[model samples]
Target: MFVDLLIGGIFAMSLLPLTTGYCAYSYGRSFWLWFALGVFLPIVSYFILFALILRQQLDHGQRLLTEAKAILAEAEEAERVQREER
Candidate 1:
């Protein structure tokens, strides 16, 4: 998980140049100001993104388990019916 987060943060940070460039151009700010924000935002955003992705994965796993249980129940019922007919 830590590795995944780190990888994601690195990828996220790649966009920083565009953001900082825009901020520098539009706001007429110094490189340092835009650079600081550009650096900071991705760390925060990456953490949030990682958490959201992890949450979604867990939810999907739970749903899969529920569906598997439902299918098992149906199969059991079918088997019971087969035995009754026999």
Candidate 2:
């Protein structure tokens, strides 16, 4: 029974790379990176990918915030200039 279980587990592990690669592709990440990680460390790769995706989203949000701040500053400056002219 132990040997059979081990064999089954190994078989399941071998298929992990395919699923990981597909997920990476869907997320616009590097499929090969996740695929290689899945082969060597399948469980850890999932969490790593999740963290990486979250970090990317956070960086994008930060950039948008920065842009908004700049636009608001520009608009405020323009309003001040108009007020001074009146």
TM-scores, one per candidate:
0.33, 0.50
Q: Flag clash pairs in model 1.
A: none
Clashing pairs in 2: none
Per-residue CA lDDT of candidate 2, range 12-63, in tens? 8878887888788876778898899989888888778878767766897866
**Candidate 1 to truth, TM:** 0.33
Tens digits of lDDT, candidate 1, 40-83: 68455444444544565579776687679789999999999999
Off by over 4 Å in 2: 1-11, 62-86
The top-ranked prediction according to TM-score is 2
lDDT of 1 at 63: 64
**Considering every candidate listed, which one attains the maximal lDDT?**
2
